[model samples]
Target: MAEAAEATAKTMLGEISQGHLECPICFCRYKDPKILDCLHTFCLNCLDGMLSKQQPSTGKITCPVCRKETPVPDAGLPGLLDCFFLSSLVDEINQQERSLETQQQATTSPTCDACEEGLEVVSRCIDCEENLCQLCKAAHVRYKRTKTHRVTPVEHPEQKEVPSADLSKTYSPKCQKHSNQEMYFYCETCKMMTCGICATIDHRSAEHQLSEITDAVRSYREEVNDVLKKFQKSKEEFKANEAAVDHARNRLKIMVTRACSAIQAKEEEDIAQIKNKSRILRDKVTEIGKKRDDEFDKVHTDNKKKMERAEEIETAVTDLMQQADDFELLNLKPKVMHNLEFQKNLQFERVKHGESFIGFKCQDVVRDKDLGEILHEEKWKLQSEFGKKGDWDGEFNCAAGIACFSNGDIAVNDINKKRLSVFTSTGHYKSMFDLNAPYGITVTSHDLLLAHCEDHVKVFDKSHQLISKFNLPLTGTDSTDQCFISPWSNNKTYTSGITVDKTNQVALVDKKTGVTSLHSLDGSLIRVIPNTKMVPIDIITNKKRCILSAMYDESELRCVDVTGKVNVTARLGQARPAGVCCDDTGDIYVTVHGNGLDKGVGEVLHFDPQGVFIGCVARAMHWPFGITFSPSGELVVADYYSVKIFHRV
Candidate 1:
């Protein structure tokens, strides 16, 4: 019974020891322990094994329990000292174990596990893990094999409290490769731990930077802290850049919304005015028709009365001649004659020929010069004029096309001179350069210009140097690089009026064939826009994804949408449109060449989007060809030998 009871006591004590003193990794008694940033304790050898296994992938020590990353310190894992509190607790547990063994041996009845001897215990042999009486102890010492074993007296007269021991400092780890040797050093070059035997054999080379495991651990801690600070700073910078980009995006949205609202309001006002004018003209026509109908009815009634009197007199004369004799007929002759004379003298009212009787007059219904007054074009005052017949810049010499740059500079294509002339926004000539029969010029970018020349498109830089050229294509050609000129017409090349769109596509028209073509930036023809019935002279684009072509031969403008479909064809009765442009409000402006060089006069005409003639915006010039608007919506025109600028008052 005593033996069973003693066994029970020892089992309870061992369970308590394992709970406080064992290393979690190896499930053994604690060895050279260290603490991590998360406050968890691990054996020194265990830390080295974990870092070696994970460092290649993570480049840092990852806590096994919490999965927190810690940068490996330069001094390495062993430089971290054993945890003081945990070490002290382990020491206390060891003391308790020894004290419990002594108490079991001192009891009146006890048995030794090693010798299986029943005795009254007098001493305990720690090495043999057995209890011994006086006789057994003497025998234990006399035995040659057991003499070196340590024995302790079981009886102590005074009772003393056992202090807690630190298990972290008490443990020593054995090498897995060489189980008999303890791991004592670390190889920095190989990032591995080694025992004393391994240090002399495997790690003996000069290339292996051997270090005391503890020293390397201290260096690792310092590096970890430094890297953590850098990571935090980078995260803050990324957040600030994101906030700035979001702010700019929101501001742009607001700007677009306000601009669209103002444009829509102006559109509504112009439409209302057009409707009111139509109503007035319709009412005037109705009143004239009603008055003419009343006057015609009165004339019809008077003619009917005279005809009835004549018919009555003819019937009475017939009855007198048949019934009465010669005497009766002669007596009725005078009366009949008087009646006939009355009928003969009766006349229908003569219609007035000088005034409009029933039809509406064109002058009353359509406003030509008078439309400018309604739109308040008088407020659009002239800013300046240059490039005139007598100007020092020299006459334009048949300028055919004009374009405005983003920076407010102006470029003109002088077909007669075969050169391009550039001027400031205020009409001061900047420079001129030779181009082969330049017909159209447009700014593809701030520094690049695309010019339509005789049979090819030429690209030029801001310095007026020709950079590249490509021939315009025609049908039955293998590529867009075909160049051909018909013998019948010298100017019947593949290109005429040209413009660049927001998408960087070049749109040009064939003047002789009336076929419009869209080309890629690299001079490859994408597709041909269907030809319109009227002859296309000049082309301009609006923000509505539509292009307007001025028909030189017809008194009309052709509107082509982005899909290459004709949207509308409208006529402005008198003006012969040579060049066309549009403002932000979709209001079109055209330069008129009324009767050619002999009698033709230059006039800038304005019209609404629907082709209702708004009026002549400008008049009384030699002849105007190309018309455009500045960024501020000011009118700019190439008047044959002059360039003119006009602005709103």
Candidate 2:
């Protein structure tokens, strides 16, 4: 039992030494421990060293653990609150270690600090923090000044009871300047604990508002408790948010895995088809070559036979002319001439095969136009609609541009109302900020708002504070030519829409130049997309980094790569395409103003990433303009007068 108790004591001592007794900064046993307002404790000398390294003009020290700043008292580092509890703990730990060491050596208990003789201690004075022997204990009880000091019996080595510190006594820390006087008052102005002497000498002014330490502690505890409660709620919120983000991450990973598998399967299938086509093509070329070779052999044989007959006839005719009579020559002439004429008339079968036309016409496999597409089965339904035609706070007057924050909050640019209205994902109005005829708006990857106002883009922080503004590249149009272009306007000089990609690059459409251009966050021109012909109104980018632009005049939705290569173009027939957005799956949702039958009606069209029309998401709207997807994957549309939200089923 004694051995077990000793082992447990050693374990506990080790824990206390490692966890609480050591200073965080110096990583050693604390000497004159001080506690910051953030509740982190460090040695006084360590704090002084840290303060000396900081800018003295700040007059504040930062906690090493939490980085919370606390004002340096006028008395400096020594004036900081002393951690009495921790100091007592350290003292107790030291005493326990000494006791354990002596027990392991089989020596007597610790000697009494009061007596000159080397005597084993029997008791400890909690107030004086000293060990005492039997004689010293009796003297301590009899002495008038020390009799009131609380004393506890110290466990001897032979005793079965484990040694423990006397932690029940209340510790009153003394003032650093006035070492003898206990600090019992708190100065409101200085925000530091002080003794009676220091309060009278330094904090006696009316502004100081000196109060009992107990009262001050109670008020501070209540305030801290209130903040702690709020923090607890915030922690819960953060936990939920973290869980949601993790779930999304897992889902995305699973989707990526499945997509990889599908792509591999498709690749194998395409390779097999290509190989089969190659084999067939090779066999056809071989068959044509064999037929041509046979025809050439037959022609060569026939030509050789004709050449031998001509040579025999030539020798016979020459002999007849030289040696035979005229009559004999005449008899052979008719037959020889007939044979020559027949030979001359004979046409050896010409090889029918033309010059070798059996070669492969290689197509660009990298940018295969017929490469398969991803099928999106999303079915969207109208979830809710908010706002009406008015100048009220939540109301909208010509809702033009729409963008969503990372938290699913929606911001709409009401051009006619001259305000930027914000709403929750569920269509609940939150707040609105005034702006000057804002047309196109986009939320950057950092959640900064960039609103197009006339010739420049105004940048605002999350709090709606104006950070900075930059002018868009001059379109060579003067101020007189600069006119406000509505979503339905066919104005060529209008700066129609803006979007931010994953790289935080701003892409905008300039109808005047009939081109789409990319810009930096500060509105500096990066590069204009070459070969963009159709007049674009609204633009958005997908996860594939392909820019999707809505050509209002041409009634087409064109998908262009970042390098200005047109990938796909979906013709909307008579309907005019306006605002465009892409979902997480890279599927597109375009808002069009007319359905070929009714010019006043509007509908949201859904398309796959390859620009193939899937189906109509929603219809029978009054001129839908700007469209975007919320963080929750809900489709948000800014119609003529109100904002409509749709959910993917």
Candidate 3:
């Protein structure tokens, strides 16, 4: 009985579900009598046929979904089920359209509804739902919208617009209790902004900080402007500094040019002086020579006249003899002829009574035998060889002085090597001497060596045996003060130079307070030579009286003749002179470094007896220090580094 009941319920449910969906035609469930007012329920193709009615001659119809009225009516039968989903879909479409409209409205946010203007309004009107500012608040807008809206101040911290759509919202921009209308500036001390009423009532008696906005703005501007001004000034100062550097560079260029010009001018002046001196000497010498020639000519002429007179007497004698012979055979007056000849000669001699005076004595001016080796231009060119080598075939630190031996050996003071090195002329090791920190070296003709070092002068014999030492007893070490030992040693303790005169006279550097006593071979102070105001850099005495001492850093290379009178002078302006030597002809050669470390500029200048500057013998050498002429007439230049040999021309 229950199963029958359930089946009956299922059948009824099916029947109800079948016609449950409504039809557009009758607005009711579909029935077997299919009607839409005309009883059409739109069954698939039949519904389309009915819907697409002929549109005035064309077959077209309005769609029910679009709410368009059909132009034709069809007599097709349909059920309610087919149009059910279409009705439900139409309901869903309408609902979704409303949701899309809502989303667009939310996306636009709240904006003014009334104005056409696009200005950004931070505040809004309550009643009119419009946005504006204080100046644009028209009373009519509020008054007209008063029925439905209200007006008030807006306050939204981050958002510029009013907190709500209505301008009637009130926000306290000021204190309400004070009822003050103006915005009082904040006082830093009080840390608050007060209304006028509050200022006069509550804050008037309180100590507080306050300032006008205009004054603060102005002060800030001034401070910033002051910093800007300083920056500008600094920029200008930097430019000035750069300009000064450039100016100094230009000045240096000018100074260098002027210095060069000065040196060149000096050369011209020196040459002119040499020419003048030579001319003067030539004039005097030529005048004297002409006088001698005139005297000789007169003597010759007188001697010829005497010879003629003798010849005439001879002829007269012959004639007298012949006449006597003729007078003996007829010879008359022969005795008177010979006597007259003699008397005539005597008379002529008396008339020309200057017999001795007629001839010149020239033995003093000429005829002196020059036996020494004379280097002439025709014989050989001047050749020089020099080199600095360690004394003991070891390393040399720094070469301070150098000297060469006669047999191709050279000696150098090795300040760094701490000993001297004797090397062959070709730079081969030979032998060396041991000594203290040596500063100077002088070689004697007999192979005796003299080296100057700290406070003592060590002397050595030819075979390198220690002979003895020379030193001044005065003992005080003051750099600024004058040295006493120097005057005694060199006649000046400034023993920068030492040379043994050919006669073995120990010559010391003087001209400064350093020179003093120079010892003899016997070890006693033979002489205490006094130093002059000048310091001699190098001292050399041939011993016959020609003491050639070259002065460093001075213009004069002075020579003292045999009479002790200093004559042969060489004037060199601004020349850093070093060593000097006198060749056989009395011609002197002086080495000029021409500015220390100015290696390429060093040259050797020759001077005549009258102090004439001949051209450079050699140039472009490394600080040519010591110079000497070899017995072979070769000039050896002892440079600080290398020794060069130039053949004397």
Candidate 4:
């Protein structure tokens, strides 16, 4: 029991020494503790040291804890508000420590404050704040004034507990200016507790709103509770967000693992195919080598037989000349001469040039064919639609062409209305200007607008003012004839679709000759793409400088390089593909005028860079013609009567 009591005493002393009893700056017991406006308390000497380090001209000092600036009292550190509650707590802790030490040492008991003679304290009165012996305790209960006070036996000072009434009687801090009066009110303007005398004097101004301290505390508590409720809701939202992020992370991990497995499987399959091809090539090489060796062997055998025949004939002719008579030599001479003549006329075949060399030609990995492509299989939904078939400012009679500015503004050209209308990205009407037979439109890198009108292309500035106009050269004719008769069927030459390449070269499609030609900004012919098989309706350019033409006659989307090399030619069945455009990711979008029973209702189809069909983006459109992507990557399609916008979800 004694050991437990000592331990308890040590714990209480330790808590007091480390907690509110200690000064934050001094890291020791607080001496003359002063509270700042920020509600942080520190030793008076520590505050004085902090103040002395600052410039004397500055009347405010920053808090050492929260860095909030507090005005210095007029009389300096001594004029700061004293913390009377903390002072009393420090004294109570000190007294408890001494009492515990005396109990541990088994010293004499404490004397009673109410006894005249020196008498040991038997009990303590909570409300009267006095210690009493047995005799004084009896008298304290018997008196009328002190009889209502609650008293408890003081057998162990360490284990003493104060009554609730005693706790309510704890000291209220006095005002800094009026030291004799306790602070009773709070000045809302100054945000400070003030004594009654100080409230009537310093805080009596109209700007200062004074409230009783108890009322102020109650109101502030409610306000803090409301804020705390909001904070709790925010905390729950953060937790929900965290959980969603964790789920996404897990899903990403699963996708990565599946992708890795697929890549490994492809790698194994490709390696096996390569090995099989290598075996076949090696076998072919061996067969060719053996055939060449056999041909060389046959030539060697024929040459060796001729040499042996000549040697034998030489021996026979020599023997007949030495040993036989002249008749025998004469008889063999004709045969020997015949044999020598035959040998002299004979010639050996030589190996052909380059026959010994065997070469392996390797195709380019990136350019010859795509090893793989990073495809964005994004799905789009119709977000909004604007404009209608009317003569209004925001309406279009025949929305033939569409273009997007770098600032997300959309420009639509109406062929029937003969006007170019501009709208915000959200499809709100901005302005319109008069134009003639505008079919296709595009915006240049410098934000200049180019519109294909009849046989000429009109260039407009950012303000929709005509800057210049250039006549498109007639097909098969060098002259820039604005009105040239088509040589094919005597039809007038018409320019339908137009697009600008990366090098600022314009590609204009002529429906009469079924040929798309590239031209400079000044309308000088660069070259013609040899695509005369199908009538080209619309054209666009990708990042690779390849022109994508929508062939309405052939129902196909054709992609060709600037040099007329065909890259991809995708057949769209019966749908007459038109209004071709590419996104920032190089994915192709073609608006098709539906065929068969679905005539008049058009659909927008998406494709990869290589012209592989991805999916249908938008369907059931009323003759969609021109297509373009907004600056924010939204799809803007110019239908016959309205402009439709689609966003990737």
Candidate 5:
């Protein structure tokens, strides 16, 4: 019981000592405790770093815990007073350590060597380090030669004394290589600890740069300070990283929440539309059934009237046969025969068309479009290729324009080859037609094809035969015969992109001067928008009739309305913006050159109608120049070598 009580008391004291020894800043035993104005204790070096990070304009330090502001003193953070309470606690702990050591030695105290009988000792002689009892302590001091031997109590024990010149003999550990010799030298060149003999032999070379063993102690202390600084910096970095990760996690959760809400809203709208359509069809069916029921009721009334008339004729014949003459009977027979023939004719006419009047035809109606609704199965995948550079009868050299028809056909124009090649939706070579210099192609109507040539747009039917040729009108002029050239040079002019709007108006860009011109398909100029601020390369239109053009100089896409007015423009963050096409859902796919993994290669990137980034559709192509969406929403890209297609998965 007494031992357990002692153990409990020791454990309580240890906890109390740990609490008093801790520094508030590092939460560890204090290195050099300092007191702040708020009486809060922290490590002096930790406080120094905290004060350094504060803005100089404040001229005051805010405590990290309590946020209490204190004016900066003339000597800065180092001027804070030392913590005397912590210092007293440290001293008490050291004294307790000494007492514990004394108690441990008491168990192993030697018996007095000079005593008559072996007895445990309580005093020691410092000169000889020998234990003695109280009675022997007096005699030991009374001895003439031993009186000046500096006798002390045996309760306290520490290191043994040695000669000053042979201080290496008192080393805590002897050398590993030479057990008899203490390691007293440090080799600066080898960066190792060595004994005196090894230093003179193995590291005896002049370039070895041997030094005193204490030199390493000084360098190690400096290295310890550097390590402490690094530890502090690492802690701060971890805190910052934790904060950034939490922020990103919260942002993603919010974005997902918003997307889910939008999806649910679209679902509700589609349900409402379906319900409305169902209600309308139900009412129409009821109304048609009532109208046909009324017609059958009229036929039933006519049959009832005929039955009454036949009964009247039978009663008259009975009356005439019983009392009247032959003349009266003959007259009744003629009327009855006429009535029977009329009833027979009516029955034949109504029964012949009974199938038509008996029931109403019900036809199924389908909704036309989905208003920007996202479907679960709408994913992208790659499809087949058509015209290659060396393929038989279907060769295209440096193709740069692509367009898709409603009949699931794809048309591409090769500027170098000067031909417009047609392909099936799944990328089968159909046919090709030659032109002067085809730059861009688009299906203007169901059967009409518009191809922008060197100086004019040539219209063609499905058979690749030229139907009409409309030369691009000169800017600020209306004459079809006159051609406009960039003021920079007459012969260096080129048009790279063309798009037809809902009004059969052709929008084309002059690549050299960045001017876009709108013209009618009948070779008439409407209006010109000058200084588009980007080198317009490819153009497309949204359902709202807004023209979106891909720019080459800054790798940006710009929007213009049908009135030839520029609206919003944004950079796509690619090395080169080559071609752009928007699907029915306002999702745009753009081809950018030099953004692929290999040099001079390219990729196709997707974006929304509002210019928000979606994702990448296809990647790592050999310079994809033009892009378009097939009727089924598959992306058709004009690679330099061949055509590439991506289908909705």
Candidate 6:
């Protein structure tokens, strides 16, 4: 008990302790490591890792060393979580080895590389003892049953893996928590085993099933030791690799010096030969060749001469000896050589890109700039914020104007049905809310959504949570009895518009006069933005910026910016443009009904900032009505009959 406590304390102190492990079974790290409830751990298969393959009963998993029977679990044994105890045990062994090494260092003769003392290599056994020369080895092997006896060659003390026998002397170990009770059997009923005395008194009538713990623990121990040993070896290597960069740098410099010396020597030799040829031709040009040929040869030869001279100077400056003092020496060498060759050749064409033996020139580089969103980041592919909708394979009746929530949910206004259903980004109908004649919808900073119904505007929080609704104040027009009444009256053609204000209040166009009425976020009607130019169709705001709806041609598609200034008025005309939206980059998109001009389905058009008519983005909508941009700016179109996402091409 004293020894166990001491071992535990020593192990606790040496978190960085080291040692190697070997499996008493297969001796490999070949199985998943696991620890049992017993704190005793091992490889799940290590027990079966030693099972006699052909025997059906090997599944019983008997211990290799003790032959105690261990019952396997019904679902098969579990793999290891890590052999914590084995690692601790290995650490104990390492500590002993370290102490042994310290002792050996003190005793060994410093001068003796081959022996502890200068005394003649003397061995009576001629086996493990030193100095057993060839003749002695023959005599040692001649003994019966001792042929090839373990003999140390007389040069050094034996270095071999020695299984620790001192483990009992120094390794004070702990019993596994579950096994501390001297596990004779495991009880299946109460999941607790009774001692031999208690087993008969309480569990004798088969209320419990029992398996021997000795075999199970032993088999597991072997597997645990194997994994711990492998991990320890890998950890040792990892620690040694801390100097990886320094090691790479030193190796690279050595290679560079060798390569440069070989290349420079070759270059110098070629230059010298060319110079000699050029001098010969210069001295006897008339006799050397035809005049034209002679002139060309002279030029080529002269250039080679110049290159050679430059190389000699370069070789002197970039000598390998300089590599030690200057880290940038390698970087400069390539540049110097390139400049010398460029000067010698006189033209880049003659400079060597390949086969001509010339060097390289590193031209300056410039990064390409992004044009804009429509041309740059195609968000549909990059963003995970939006995904497909459900029942997307068939036509989706999107009457309740569709708006995309920032969290990838969609609020579709089911106009005739008066049902505002919240669909998941995947088109899965999550929940629904009731609204009368809901038409247009937009999201807000407070997680609330602004929606337009018939005569009143409804506000909903992110999860279809109700905030409040606003009813239009009465304003008589046309005649006394025929004049539009409040909320639900004549001339009350609320064209589905909702806008937000500086105080985070929401506003909407009265749809009758194009007057912009602002309201508190809590749905209290504040007032109208008097003198609005056109009747409003839809409203959108993102707190920092706001968009007011108005007529652009026959379609209601004029976009307003943060300062209540008009930025872009869309230029798409088809059946009758109904809904419009602008991305962060101020590009406008509008949905229109089926046009007689194209004789096709309704379509969506895109326009650049300058109102330069970009082009039609998407087609084939039965009656594409309300359009909105996702937070990421992908075009979300609620086709009066179906909803689809389109990229601004």
Using TM-score as the yardstick, the better of models 3 and 5 is 5
Clashes of each: 25, 0, 70, 0, 2, 11
Q: Please tell me which predicted candidate would have the highest TM-score against the true structure.
A: 2
Question: Over 4 Å off in model 1, which ranges?
Answer: 1-378, 390-393, 445-447, 476-496, 533-535, 595-600
Point out the worst 10-residue segment of candidate 2 by lDDT.
Answer: 352-361
What digit string (tens of lDDT, one per residue) describes model 4 on residues 206-311?
A: 9999988777655654543454454445444444333333332332333333333433443345544444444444455445544544554554555555444444
After superposition, candidate 4 runs with Cα above 4 Å error: 1-377, 477-495, 530-534, 597-600
Reference-based lDDT, each prediction: 0.61, 0.69, 0.48, 0.68, 0.60, 0.47
Greater TM-score among 1 and 3 belongs to 1
Q: Considering summed lDDT, which 10 consecutive residues are worst modelled in model 4?
A: 160-169
| Model 5: pairs clashing at backbone N, Cα or C within 3 Å | 124-154, 379-649
State model 1's lDDT: 0.61
1-649 per-residue lDDT for model 5 (tens digits): 5346445645755786676677767777676676544334678778878878877667777766546566667887666555444555555565655654454454455788668767778788888677788888888999998898887776645533221221112223466789998777767677556789898889989899876655655554354345345444544443433333333233333333333444344445564555554444434434443444454445445544544443443343333344322222222333323333432333311311111111111233346543232222234667787666763456776678888887988887776666677888877778887755534677775657887775677888777788888876554322332222223334422235688876787887654444577888787888776655334567887766778877765678788875657665668665667788876545567888764335346888876555655567777787787898776556889886788888653
Greater-lDDT candidate between 1 and 4: 4
Cα distance off (Å), candidate 2, residue 495 = 5.7
Encode model 2's per-residue lDDT on 1-649: one tens digit a residue. Answer: 7678788989988997997579989999999987665445799999989989998689999988657688899998898766666677788889888878777766435899998898888999999999999999999989999999999999864633337788544656678899999887877677667899999999987888898876765565454345445444544444433333333333333333443444444455565544544444444445544554454455556554544444444444444344333222222333334433433344333322222112222333343342233322335678899989888888876787899999888998877667888888887899888886344889998889988775578899998789999876755433343323553445422234678998999876554455567899877898877776445667888877888888877888888886778887889898888899986656678999784445458999977665656678898898788999887557899986889998644
lDDT of 5 at 499: 85
Residues 543-599 of candidate 3 have per-residue lDDT tens digits of: 254567676646578765434466556778878677677654445677776643455
RMSD of each: 42.6, 40.1, 53.9, 40.6, 40.4, 34.3
* Model 1 lDDT tens row, 106-149: 54355554455565677999999888888889989999999999
Query: Against the true structure, candidate 6 has what lDDT?
Result: 0.47
Q: Tell me how far the alpha carbon of residue 175 in candidate 4 is from the true structure, in angstroms, after superposition.
A: 99
What lDDT tens digits, residue by residue, belong to model 6 across residues 505-538? Answer: 7666655545556667665666545445455445
